[model samples]
Target chain A: MPRENPLAPVERELRVAPRHRLDLVNEVDADVLALQAELERRGYGPAEARRAAVARLVPGGRVIRQLEDRHRPLLGRRVLASGWMDRAVAVGAGAAAAFAGVVAVVATASPGGAGMTAAIRWLLVFVAALMAANLGRAAARLWVQGDLRQEERQLLWARQTGLIVAAVAAGALGAAWEGYPVPGTSVGAGGPAFVPQSAVWEAIGSVAGVAVVGLAVAVFGLFGWLLVTPRLITDEECERRIDDFFAQSRPRLTPDSTKAQSHAQ
Target chain B: MQVTLSKRINELLVLAVLDQGPAHGYQIALAVEEQTGGSFSFQHGTLYPILHRLEADGRLRAEWHGTGRRRKTYEITGAGRAELAAGAAELEVQFRALLGLLRGCHAA
Candidate 1:
């Protein structure tokens, strides 16, 4: 007869949902036990074999999180849940908000006329892109499942995008300097095309403008890159974190197993 | 050495091994660890996500060996073979680029 999984207690503690329990998994139980048996045959003491087997597991919290992508709740239900879903829903609900922000831009601007409007429009795109990217990062965290390396790459992408936008903002400021009407009264004509003061984005003030698939799309694209390029972690600190953070939840070693190990030794 | 692998490499490596024949997770983990001389070790549990993801992505298929232990044996699908081929080609290109870059630095 099959034995109870060694990890049932840990599973209970984690309250791994019924849907994911199958995956929690019987395979792991079998593997750990089989490895333990093999180790004992090879003259490893019971405790030593048990330790060796336990060390092979991923970790507890991570097992549930990693499988989240596979066992994600149904769409309508998922959006109702908080956290990353809120980020996704906020982006989804943004069409109405985008319309309102457009109205705000229309109502708020002084008679700085078409020049200010044009400058504001470009600036709007820049600021909205940044906000959406920052907010959407929460969602990407779900996709990465706490892989610091992926998080590192995501942060790098965000910084690069910020720089590119800044470069374009500089050019726009230059145009405004040439009497092209930069976004704000702060940027008086011929004053500096690039205002050294106040974020060039200050122009999007009162504009709740944000919502785009760019950062998340880029994150997904990065996964494609990640699949082909492997970065091996050899650093002790980094490896330990990855090991601790990415492992499957496993059953605690039983006192009985320890005793067997001691007796064998 | 207990090196940590990015999911990218893990998927490709698992698919490459599965392509040889269907095997359980333990078998796959052992095979890779042994073959790599301990350089590409997995914490055993880490391999499951990649296995399940590939299965979800339709690149691999899994079946239970028996109900008692429920040992899952995974095999690469046609899509998996195609992915393995493409990924292997890309890795080769990267390896060559890395080698050339290092060589240039040495020559300098």
Candidate 2:
């Protein structure tokens, strides 16, 4: 036979709610049990105090409804609400802008290159266009989604977005100036260029090689950063964020207080 | 008769009460009601969610203090105290501003 739960009726009622959390039910069990004991200690009969405790705590199924609103799986809401998501988006855009920097460098450095360079220049150029498209894409999201928890954080998000845009603009101009096409000169002729014309494929290979190295460095840096920094926000922060969801998640004026105030008046 | 408090005020009050000393759910709620001179009260049902949420946030630390129907007692953490201090200051400012506005209205 199972041990008797003194707050069985209260527990049973809370449990009856659809998809109710057991942890909450148990806590309520302890609360009501304690309240009943306190009432008994204050001179109420055992049975009367038990009945009163249940009535006081679980009034009209309100708590169960409030719990449903406040404590349901909050990962989706947190992903939207936590300021870090916007930060991550800003960081991503910044990295793409940095890659755009490489694009400007390659474009101005493309003329009169060594052999085998043009062979891979096209691929790097493709990636450069892709970054430009991504910068625009990221910028669009920033305009529509500035919903952070605090005004200060929202301002930070704006600043980060601004920095990303600045980087992109500067990177494009610099790379274009540096990698300008040679004037009136074919691959075999002297022209307005930097490195002397030779193996186009080899220059392309060199750019790709540099890109590979940069990508490897970024991956390792991100991994190391993750290893060192502890995640600041936990599920608890979500509970705080959704304050309005559980509109009645609050304490109340007890019957005793009202009587005390009324008697004094 | 029960008067439900706003969550922010309730949280602030809870933290303030716990700052005095450690207590379990029932004792904390009772203390708040008694100390407020019947101005505030907490239902067992309504308070558990807040307590659990606070515990999760590291604002309050809980430990089962006794055996055989032993209750889970809560102590205010450093974070809880910091929040309480901030909240108290904000509330005081708001009340002062409110009082000033009301007095000006009466004068008018």
Model 1 compared with the native: what TM-score? Answer: 0.47
Which digits, one per residue and each the tens of the lDDT, describe model 2 over residues A121-141? 443444454534433343333
For A1-265, candidate 1 gives per-residue lDDT tens digits of 4443446544443322232454455656666666665567678887787777666753455764565555454452345353556676566457435743653454335232244445554454454444445434433433323222434555745664564455345334533443432345445555755664444444333222211112222343344344423322222243443234225433434333543332222
Q: Candidate 1, after superposition: displacement of residue A227 in Å?
A: 40
Candidate 2 Cα lDDT to native: 0.53
Q: Give model 2's share of reference contacts.
A: 0.31
TM-score for chain B of each model, two decimals: 0.87, 0.85
Per-residue C-alpha lDDT of model 1 across residues B17-107, encoded as one tens digit per residue: 8888887776788778888789897773677778888998899998876533346678999999999999889788978999999999999
Give stretches of model 2 more than 4 Å off: A1-20, A74-265, B1-5, B65-70
**Residue B31 displacement in candidate 2 (angstroms):** 0.7
List the RMSD of every prediction in angstroms: 18.4, 14.8
